[model samples]
Target: MGDTHKDLIFLIPLPGGRVARVPIDVLEHYVDPSARISHGGEAEEEDVTAHSMSVDPRTGASIWHTDWELGQCDYTDENGFPQSAYAWHRHPLGNEYTEIYQK
Candidate 1:
């Protein structure tokens, strides 16, 4: 089956045992800015959100998550070397916000 379209909300538990209510399909934009989990002593920025989690806070379990995927033949270059994932990223050009990674 394809992606389902429905009005839904997810209740995610947060720090201090707080629970966050987030709308389906748009949780990333609504992440709790202050939430953080130990990732090499740094925050996971986009993954460790109150609305969405890459890990299970209780067990420290995690799964791979990436916003983009490579297309079939888009994996390598003419040299047969793996393409850099960073090359696919485009910074937010034009002044919409002072922060470059706002989105």
Candidate 2:
């Protein structure tokens, strides 16, 4: 798929931690979908975004979005439980996961 006109939508975090994302198009910050990105690699600070949109099932309209981080990890210790493995998912929709991570 080409540009969904939905790429690189971002929320610039404020110093006070009050989250606010502009609903306008800032052409300079758009990340081209076709551009190649290294798999499991760290994206630059500017490329990181923190917003998720949920469309209304019935209306097909974007009814909600939020600026919060959700971390997902998969690692097991010798005991077979969850190990404290950590990493960042720095893709376009990256959450900047709360735990430590490598690119």
Residue lDDT tens for model 1, 1-103 = 2455545777864434467887677876667654333222344554543221245455565532232211111134457665432222121232111111112
Clashing pairs in 2: 87-101
Top lDDT model: 2
lDDT of 1: 0.37
Model 2 residue 23 distance off true place after TM-score fit, in angstroms: 2.9
lDDT of each: 0.37, 0.38
lDDT value for candidate 2? 0.38
Q: Model 2: runs farther than 4 Å from truth?
A: 1-18, 35-71, 75-103
